[model samples]
Target: MPIRYFIKQWLMPPGLLLLLLLGAWWLRKRRPRLALACFVAGLGGFWLMSLPLVVEQVARQLETEPPLSVQAWSGLAGRADAIVVLGAGRERGDLAWGGQDQPTGTALERMRFAAQLAKASGLPVLTSGGLHYGTPPSEARLMADRLRDDFGVVVKWQEEGSRTTWENAQMSAAVLQPLGIRRVVVVTQAWHMQRSRWSFEQAGFEVVPGPVGFLGQDHGRPFAGLLPDNRAIWQSGQLLNEVAGLVGYRLFY
Candidate 1:
């Protein structure tokens, strides 16, 4: 694994929270006051991260792109030339699927929505993603297969060399722009559309944001969402990662 990956894991929640707890343990005898602070910080951070209400509130701010209305789906052809589905990642070999890798839930969401859009607008489709950790069968390939088998939509293009949002735009452009396709509708998680749009625009394409899988709505959980849930931790982590990505893109890209 790359050092950057380790660095990111340590800096982000769960890992960061673990460090705080370890600090509390190490300082319990010597620096009692500081130890207590670390314990409180770590525990409180975990508590906040596991709450559904916190996830909804934070995701609402990040997911600013509104969903495309059903009434406008058929009219998308006039607004763009192609539909691009951004890959989210893949689930490694599973016995249920005969050990073949499959698209992650996030990727499936994009593909499902992209399929509907493609069918509605009669636009060709492109799947954008690269290999996972340098493995074979890139995310694009996995998405293409799923889209064909499950949704009955054949992908017109597969940009299989991008590992990040910036690369997704640049690489997809390399394929589409050569074919005189300069306008496209991009499909991804609602929270990710902002960065995806900015990157595609920078890569010299007119972008139509096609956001899906919104997390900023009421779940009607017990106790009015105040109760902590395990899934909330993952959701909160995604939003935090997006915030970090947005900041990193502004600084580095």
Candidate 2:
């Protein structure tokens, strides 16, 4: 639907890499040199990205924040005012869930950690997300519902008009600042926490990073570490997207 979405999907791996491979195949006979170059670039990029260890190394650049200690998590009251859970995009209509859009895996992971933090901290929560391509049932609503129904935590505020992390901070600021709540615990993936913290601080909040789903940790999964995996490709894509966002936000924001 959106031009930028198309450009991004095409630029990222599987799209660009696959296109290169196809182009190589098409030109192999007439344009031997060009085809060889394309084949090497495409196959090389794909091969390098599919390794689990490679993903962790790149992710480590952004996954600097660590999880809270058990002692710190055990006593979280007075640490902050509320938990601000950032939204990941939702899954489109699915027959399994009665055609209702559901929270994406990343969103659910953030919600899971936020729930545990809220329960231990005695804090209220807010879900920040806007519509998907101007569609109804904003990500905030889906997140609020999941937090309430699945996690037993009532969302106190739903900042339902932010599509980017910058907006997440600014819109949440508009809602929270008016109420004199300037300190908050922001919850998101560890790889996302750095940029999330910077944006929220820019919007005037004392941010407490509540990072979850820590990545880049060596797992020593035998040969699986070096082998190509579909999931690793996806993970690498996520990390690359974050890197792009970090650079773009720093330049424009």
Candidates' C-alpha lDDT: 0.94, 0.90
**Candidate 1: residue 127 lDDT (0-100):** 98
lDDT of 2 by residue, 170-206 (tens): 9999999999888999999999999999999999999
Error of 1 at 85 (Å): 0.5
Please list the residue runs of candidate 1 whose C-alpha ends up more than 4 Å from where it truly belongs after superposition: none
Error of 1 at 22 (Å): 0.9
- The C-alpha stretches of model 2 lying farther than 4 A from their native spots are 26-31
- Tens digit per residue, CA lDDT, model 1, 1-253: 4898899898999889999999999999999999999999999999999999998899898888889999999999999999999999999996799999999999998999999999999999999999997898999999999999999999999999999999999999999999999999999999998899999999999998999988888988789789989999999889999998999998998
Error of 1 at 4 (Å): 1.6
TM-score each candidate.
0.98, 0.93
The model with the greatest lDDT is: 1
Error of 1 at 89 (Å): 0.6
